[model samples]
Target: MTSTRATVDHYERLAASHDHNWTHSGVFLDWMTSQIVSAASIGATDRVADVGSGTGLFARHIADQVHPAQPILCVDTSRPMLTQIPTSPEPQPVVAPAEEMAEWVTAGGGAGTAGELDVILLKESVHTR
Candidate 1:
């Protein structure tokens, strides 16, 4: 039967091409980003988490809105997928299941921060929840 392990493994193999398949640089993505960012009301100071942030499809755009203030956490179960994001020096990527993200945040994976998330996005990861 298909399970979370199988899902994560699949993503690990697909990580490199996930962005391309998702048309990350295309118009539809741009519009989606705008809508999500607007709906989330993400600001420079908002602490955000892009759950199921495969290849950073949405996290990259969210970063532009939150950068230099605080990096948005790119939380995903697959290490390969998390690593695909072009994020650095910001502690942006956290390898964790979407459902357990709050524990990671509270346990100081994102230390020195409050035990709350300002914004959480699960656009393509709703299945995980």
Candidate 2:
């Protein structure tokens, strides 16, 4: 059986390339992302969590829609994947598996002035849930 740790290690190894590969998805990704963001109706005061946030593509996209001070927690099992997120307002990289994300957040991982997450975008991570 494939263990979770082994899967995480694989993602760590592929983090950089993962970000690069998303570019090839092209307009499909952009359109899908736009639809998600639009439907999320994220407010400036909303705290957001992007679980399984590899390279923070979805988190980065939503950063602009949320408040400048609102925290966007980027939780992933792979540290290398979290590191791939480009510098922006401020991306909180929490290294943890999807299963433990709720506990981590409860322990103040993603807590901001606005409190807990108002919006959470799981995207391809639905399986993890």
Candidate 3:
């Protein structure tokens, strides 16, 4: 069996290519953005979580719409992927595994500002878990 650390390292490498592949498809991003925006109203003061936020593409877009008041959390197992996110004043990015998110939720850490997440977006990373 692969060690957890090795698995994480592997994902970090994969993340480097994630944006190149996903962002190239404009249609996919547009569809995803529309869905995310429609489902989680951009202006709503909600606690949102994005799991496997590869390169933070969707998270960044959502943050742009939501702005400073709303809290958005970008969680990903890949450190490299998390680093690529723009250092903007909006959403905050956290390096973590999707399955381990409950710890943060229970402890009220990172993106768990108010309490439980109002919206949790898995995106295309669900099957990986």
lDDT: which is higher, 1 or 3?
1
Model 3 residue 100 lDDT? 71
What global local distance difference test value does model 2 have? 0.70
Q: What are the lDDT scores of the predictions, listed in order?
A: 0.72, 0.70, 0.71
| lDDT per residue (tens digit) for residues 1-129 in model 1 | 123766767887888887777535557766787798888787877778888776776788666545637767777778898788775755378877765786776775545654567888887873642
Q: Write the per-residue lDDT of candidate 3 for residues 1-129, one digit (tens) a residue.
A: 112766677767777676776544777666778777887665557778888776788887777656636657788777788888777765677777765787878877653366577788887673442
Best-performing candidate as measured by TM-score? 1
Candidate 1: clashing pairs of residues: none
Model 1 quality (TM-score) = 0.80
Error of 1 at 101 (Å): 0.9
Best-matching candidate per lDDT: 1
Candidate 2 TM-score, true structure as reference = 0.77
Using TM-score as the yardstick, the better of models 1 and 2 is 1
Which has the better lDDT: candidate 2, or candidate 3?
Answer: 3
C-alpha RMSD values across all candidates? 3.0, 3.3, 3.3
